[model samples]
Target: MKVKGHCLCEKVEFSISVESKRFDACHCSMCLRWGGGPALTVEAENGVDFADEAFVKVYSSSQWAERGFCSHCGTHLFYRLKEGNFWNVPLGVLEDRNSFEFSTQIFVDHKLGNYDFANKTKMMTEEDVLKAFGAET
Candidate 1:
């Protein structure tokens, strides 16, 4: 599927080619702290292209990954793997959010106690996430 989206200030716009209509939520400490809650994202493993790259700023949040946001609006754009073409884009930024399905949650063990989702998602703990991504815990 191809999805188009823009930043809150409309200064940054992008389009992504995704293989699935499914999205995942990340409950890791970094993710939660970055967004002030779980980071609900959709994988754009196929490709992503930005219309106004200058409006976007990327922060190297980790050794293996980087996070991007709109410089003008501070809207989170994506969390991307530095070594690959894979990108996890925030679901809220997408124009057609109604078609996406919540399929999984990563770093489930790090999820806070204050909230929970009713969806039947495949949950993976921090350890599982580390192993899946070949990262040291």
Candidate 2:
């Protein structure tokens, strides 16, 4: 399916093709802080192609992850890692909200104390997450 996404201000938009079942939610600390919870991330092998550079700003969140957002509105765009070329796009940013479904949950160990996952989404550790994407960190 062709997944379409845009920033909150609509200044930045993008399109990518991905399998529905490949979508995942990440509960890592940086992801949680970035999205205020689990970051609904989908791997785009082709990476994100920005509609405009005026709105997109990148933040080096860590040695492993760098976050991108709208410079005008601060809308989180994508989270990137050096080890993986795939851009992790947030599901909430998609124009077609129902275009994807949660396939798995990563970093369950780092998830918040009050929240718990009820669905059948597979939970994995930091190692599993990094290994899945071939990331060392």
Candidate 3:
């Protein structure tokens, strides 16, 4: 499905022209710290465009990861890195959030004990996540 998303203030907006069901979440420290727990993420198939450059603040959170948020309201948007060739976009920022089906939960080992995903989602260890993404966190 075609998905469009914007920041909390609607000043920044973007559209993704691909199937949204491919989105996933990550529980790694960097992602959790930047996005307040599991980061709802997806790979922008072609690419994403910013409605306004000033709307998002990019923070280099780690050696391999960086995060983006709305500067106006501090709405966390994405956690991305140079993953070979693809960039990870936060699924929550998509306008049509329901279009995506959250399947796997990555980096379960680094997740805090207070939070849990014991229902049905696949919980992946750091090694498994890195292996699936073809990179190490």
Q: Please report the candidate that would top TM-score against the real structure.
A: 1
Model 2 clash pairs? none
Residue-pair clash count for candidate 1: 0
What would the per-residue lDDT of candidate 2 be over residues 1-137, giving only the tens digit for each residue? Answer: 67788988899988866766367888888887777888887877678877677888899998777889999888888888766575888877887767566688988888889987677877798888779867665
TM agreement with the true structure for every prediction: 0.94, 0.88, 0.83
Best by lDDT: 1
Residue 126 error, candidate 2, Å: 1.2
* Candidate 2 vs candidate 3, TM-score winner: 2
Give the winner by TM-score: 1 or 3: 1
Off by over 4 Å in 3: none
Q: In candidate 1, what are the lDDT values of residues 76-104, reduced to their tens digit?
A: 99999888788889999999888999999
Q: Which candidate order results from sorting by lDDT in descending order?
A: 1, 2, 3
**How many steric clashes between backbone atoms does each model show?**
0, 0, 1
lDDT for 121 in candidate 2 is: 79
Residue 137 lDDT in candidate 2: 58
Superposed Cα RMSD, model 3: 2.2
